[model samples]
Target chain A: MSHRDPLTPFLSVDAARVRRNVERVQAAADARGVALRPHVKTHKVPQLARLQVEAGEVGITVATLGEAETFVAAGLDDVLVAYPVLLDEAGLRRAAALAERARLVVGVDAVEGVRRAAPLAGRVAISIEVDSGHHRTGVAPGEAGAVAAAAADAGIEVAGVFTFPGHSYAPGAGPDAAAAELAALDAAADAARARGVEVPVRSGGSTPSLAASLAAPRVPDELRPGVYLFGDAQQWELGRTGPDDVALTCVASVVSTVGGRVVLDAGSKALGADRAAYATGFGRLLDHPDARIVQLSEHHAVVELGDAPLPRVGERLRVVPNHVCAAVNLADELWIDGEPVPVAARGRNA
Target chain B: MSHRDPLTPFLSVDAARVRRNVERVQAAADARGVALRPHVKTHKVPQLARLQVEAGEVGITVATLGEAETFVAAGLDDVLVAYPVLLDEAGLRRAAALAERARLVVGVDAVEGVRRAAPLAGRVAISIEVDSGHHRTGVAPGEAGAVAAAAADAGIEVAGVFTFPGHSYAPGAGPDAAAAELAALDAAADAARARGVEVPVRSGGSTPSLAASLAAPRVPDELRPGVYLFGDAQQWELGRTGPDDVALTCVASVVSTVGGRVVLDAGSKALGADRAAYATGFGRLLDHPDARIVQLSEHHAVVELGDAPLPRVGERLRVVPNHVCAAVNLADELWIDGEPVPVAARGRNA
Candidate 1:
């Protein structure tokens, strides 16, 4: 690949590093006898999805119908929208169209969600989302059976049970969050089976819980980890991945330096303003590990160089953002190696 | 405009309220005899820029060259990029091209920026950005004269002096920040005059300090307020504007309800993850004032309804985000009244 410096405040991905990450995760999942269905929400690039599929991913997972449509349009047939989608008329139409093109599996946490998705009964499979300590979007473990039954009664095919161990993102919370995810998925699956419904696919796993998933008493049949491919500062801080494992970074130029403080052109708009409670700073400068992003405006990241030399004007620095998914969503394209790849689902927030 | 409900998690603007906000701010600026140059970073729509110009704004202020280019291409001239630009090769080329289309004014905070931008000698005018306690980007008030002199020595025209009272975003800091902005601009202007340089324009003001600007000892010649046109939750919490004054809101659907907690389709990807330290919550539900967003994921905003009726599935709720500029950047289009208008400069963060 060419070594030309990319435009400042642009996203760049090391293709070799991404391939290695993909193979590493796939091998881990394979060793555990669990199918790896990488979440495309992290990169939102069809080419990366294709790479995952070629690397032995069973299918792909998405968070929005817009993302599912984008993946389906790119010829990725099997897709799961792991979100409790609000079935408005417009949403139903979009989901129905997507179901026509792929083996679309949608998540439902409430009976109303099932009733709303009844129109696409034959076309779409419904997966009951169980709360696994995240408490963001999902039903209680005991309520999953009723939701699954409701979907089945409405003539929809039951996909199975799924939960996101999102709490695993917190520092020192991965193992417990993974254990909770296993219990929740097992309880939901048992509840569905007791109601005479078949639980075909059980899915659970986040970047932080990927390894924890393998050690759980009841391992999930499939894992859907997104951010593991492009490690972030949060992942680095959590010890889930080392600095060398980070594949994607925002290449930014030092725009201004005054009062011993350096400012990069990358800001919330480039690195995203997602600061986990455990995150040390907004982002970490790859070249200068000692530097910390003290402040972020819409277009500037103020860096406090503790002991590292201050970056000169126009000098580019790679920054590993606090959250990779949010960072990727903000980018229009990814500079893979030296080639520009469109972030097809960049703003696909439906 | 049609009366159909838009897709969930989409940005919607009230045309009437935007017009009212424009007139309100315009009247305020006119009363103080200060030219209003609305910062387009808030809305990023050319149509809104035209509305501001039609409402008596002398010109428009932008935060990036991409934004300046967007406005200039839309036929609106006299653009001021209120940023201490790095002036890298690509940046200089872009600035030169924008200067050909409009009266381009760029900000410089150091001699390096002035030297890098000297290539645009006759085409671009440079404004020395003075630090008014923000400490984000800008030279000290006393140092602005040297930067202005350096720019003049390089054959670039000196436009004037400007500072952003960004510290005013905090609660109870408006009056003090406004006074500081005025003092900084005044000091910079005096320094420039003493250096035998003409300071033609003196610009300062943010949304929080718009009202305080009028009462400052030395009122600025121009006011550049961005978020005033679309009030947010931070503005509401800071008592700058009431809930009724908010012109923009994200229309989201109640996707799930479990364990007395309701979840909306709007998440960080929709509402933007910009919770100011002094802000109340991620966002405020306009229809249900008692409802507060407790947590946000990539695709779900968990709301804790306090004594308010829980919304059912498929119900749409308007959310006033904590920061309007960050929220607008995440959206691809704005549903104005009932029609969709593309956020022309949505990801123009070059």
Candidate 2:
């Protein structure tokens, strides 16, 4: 029933918790003797990516050319874009620009994608995407060697193979999906080795599959997990992390009470409309455990309470959004432990 | 299929179309002798609000204290917050400051809300909200008189009654819903008049209901319509508008082609994630009518095109987002007739 400040509905990141999670993930990779290339798609914060690098991460992963440019401008080298990029003329020019400053690695899963990225083939390294089980965008695992061979034929250096284990985020499917991802990567690596090409790195790991995938015998040389740095409702539900591990939270205020529903200042704009398939509500109210975000709009979230009284107007509370990645992408800056911290790469979504 | 601009994901609004829509609505209101208090919530731009005023609007309607403050700072003289506002200390102080320069009207739907506004009553005019079947906010029609009487007792002048026929947005529902809204407002106005309170203005109407409601029997003194200025997918689906009337559109480039799915550079951040229950897809592509936005992320919208074949990676397309209000809220500047116009009141989401 109290607000420390009136400016509610903003992004707040617990710096201590973020630092701890970053270090813990690095330690996990250290134990496995696999290099950690934490994905910047989660926080999109150059400061956090730098912390990971300082904590012994070998490199950082990005999803877009804009994101890679942002991190490279911030003086971070060794950036890999995990997404299967389809570069236009502008995108090709951007990739070459990034290659001038950092060790840029671009992902390609198709023959046409390689042709599109031909302009930067000599300048940047290319990685083949192996469709493990997600069936989203990557080429089949058996096709990886062919894709890699094609890229090599196009004058692009095929550095390694990578798969997303996107099914790992599915409910009760993390471990099995991680196992499948490792198996696919192993098959692709074997195929590449048979073709007299060295698959220097085989990367595959999501936050939910990080622990189990890293423990697998064939986890390759590097692991890429994004959301482990900022635990979300899905992470908590999947048992991949605990409440204390969550780094970012939406600081919102109770705005109005019409009938039984109490509306909050934060809505899809601040918290994001990313309700996990298995999540219970739109978000979790840390201040009121019994409160559930029933509905959300661009600027309003209606919270419903069960056997608990609603918070008064002007009362600020912390909300753990369903998906941390999307929520962080919407904000321009974040409060690091109640202290405003600039998110330098917030708007570089594309 | 060509975007000469470097920015891939952007929204463009035709200034001439906006002017036409503004003038059309103003003329419609003038013919009915109803004051046009256009809602600025849909497009939080002071310049656009000024356009409404210049087109002979009686005032401007807002949705939050932050918006009121923003418009007031930009020299808008009359503003009405259509939502039932909770006047907390900070909100009251802001309202007091805004009242110093502009005519401020705050909505109240409950006795408690009126009591909360008592401190700021001296500086604001209160309008009691009646539930006109929107069921989102406001009290029932029978309960409006008591709330209006309470506001009078608290020294807050009951300017009149207002309601939103939100149900009017549904197919085949606009006329009846608008009629119901007028009936509710009529009953509430009569009740307030019986209580010896001067009910000078009775307001109700959304975009779908505006045209019919203006012609309805016992039309209110003022009309507040937000989305008419920027026709979106919702308007098109409801048969209230045509594609040519869509002034705002998000321009994005085709980023990738995987099997039948084509990924675009724009996503929730640019097009917004607002979808109505009856909406077919996230948005409609202006050039590629066969493509549909199947899935959306923070930075990418997965568009699927069937047999028509997707556009090339470098090709650009314009997308009419499902909801224009939320999409407008996400941008800092809007492209008006292909020119980037600064949105003076953008990001005042509170």
Candidate 3:
């Protein structure tokens, strides 16, 4: 208690673990003869993206225009926004400016989305999104041709076709999701070719489905695996990553301990309350495997001491969030090797 | 598409509505013969807290040391941190420094918590917390005297007791939770008094149980109701707040609209993915009453078009988040009166 623990409940990233994770995934992508375009949405840091670039990554995928701007501002030359952006006039202007500085490709799920970005025709390219079992976004595989044709007509280059295998998040669902991704990408490319559009690039990947995506009958030309950078409780429970692969943890202080109840300062605000149906608790303690975080208020996490000794008040614990992306989104900075690194693109969800 | 909607997804707050809500709650507290010490956890803005002060609030309540530091740095004088802070030497030094500038009261539930803050015994006072059915934090009512005696022996002034009736959030549990809160406060105070401690200040509140906390057999000396400043969908659905009372909204654009499927740019990151067992959707559209958000990804929300007409791509809609606190915590600034006001205390979760 005399010595400070840098500030309780901050995000602590293991630099060595992150570097190993990057090398491991990059090597896998290289062996598959596919270009690794790591998604910066997982760790929104420019320095981490540089590590990916050094590992031979072709480009980076982002979820929002803000992320694209953040990386490009940090001197990255290529970015792919893998979400259909229905831009207003201001956004179009920002996209136009960003496209001038970097090679930018925006995802489009419908002809309407393609027409909306018509103003940035020559400056930016459009990638038609196809539904590959995720069903959260993207149009049907057969509908990709119409959107691709629409982008061509709007004077925007039909850069490629892509899909997000979101369903691969469940346990034992990766291989099937990867197969669906490949089949959808192939069908989408064929449809675009039928419409007199040249589909050269095929992009697909999610953390859980990355390995299977490469080993499928037809590997995609590019992959966008985000959560692989720092495995979370979901990936651990789903058997997507080994024990040593989780590179980040929320360092929290035990604020209250009475009988079986152990409370931590990292609550829903720190660890995030995005629980999977298969997850056993709200979050997992990295050091104590048996302890279960049963509940979360804004500033408190109630831990059920399962076979683990009850920690004294003021003791610190390393917590791995249910979803790392959600947890990182809440913090303003990251603590890497005891030094604070700004989450440069934090609160840039738009 | 031609006219810009500021930004696709951003937090928008109605200043007039927030003012009315402040006056309304302050009036209620006044009539109940209690000093309003509004919790700043909901809307972490000093200006809103200033509105409460102008409405006759005696002091302000916060949940964390970071929040207390934020409000105090913003020129707030009297601050009460309503959570037990297990401080290290650095935090103790900070608390001591803060106590010198402001009349600070920190909550203590365990004897260890009192000992940890004993360095600021003369400058800072300690408030004993009692468990009032929220089982989240606090000790039992009978245990208050032991903690109070420890604080009294540590040369710290005892600031009486407090309880948060979090169970009042359920549909019909307001009255019962309020009754439990009042009873716990009385019992905890009596126990402290028996230990030769002057138990003068009794604090109890939560937005849902504010009215019942006043009308119960006994009224608390102070009320610390948060979330009443900005009504959310949970408050609306639970019958705690009127439709017109909601002051904040997240303005989002329809990113994709194809046949029966419509997607908005506001996803779990913008609106947050905290869903109670009783909540119907991730959030509710203010303009469309029947639409339900079926799923939320990082930057995309899938909407089920229920009797409402499909909003075209680029169309903007005002959305009321399920929980206002979680939503506000995600944004960098608030668009109030068509101007940007920085959420200065954003990411002060430590």
DockQ (Cα-based) for each candidate = 0.62, 0.38, 0.58
- In order, the candidates keep a fraction of the true contacts of 0.70, 0.26, 0.57
Ranking by lDDT: 1, 3, 2
lDDT (tens digit, per residue) of candidate 1 on A54-156: 9999999999998998999999999999998777677788888887888999988888889988999889888889999887878889888898788779999
lDDT of 2 by residue, B1-350 (tens): 23335376777888888999999888888888988888898888888899989999989998778888888988899999887776777678888888999999998878888888998867899888887886666778877778878888988888879988878878888889889988999889888877777789999888999878877776778889999998988788887878877889988877666565677878777777666768778888766666678777666687766666657766778888888887776676787776777666655556
Cα lDDT for residue B146, candidate 2: 82
Candidates' chain A TM-scores: 0.97, 0.94, 0.97
Tell me candidate 3's TM-score on chain B: 0.96
For all the models shown, what interface RMSD does each have? 2.7, 3.7, 2.3
lDDT of 3 by residue, B1-350 (tens): 32223576888889999999989888877787888899898889888888888889999999888898888988899998988887777678778888877899988888888888788878999898889988878989998988888988999899869999999989889899988988999999999888888888989999889878877767889989888889898888788887688899889888877645788899888888788889888888777777778788888888886888777788788888888889988888888878888787887887
**For model 1, what is the C-alpha lDDT against the true structure?**
0.88
Q: What's the C-alpha lDDT at position B296 in model 3?
A: 82
Candidates 1 and 3: which is better by DockQ?
Answer: 1
Q: Which pairs of residues clash in candidate 3, taking residues 3 or more apart in a chain or in different chains?
A: none
| Backbone clashes (count) for model 2 | 0
Docking class of 2: acceptable
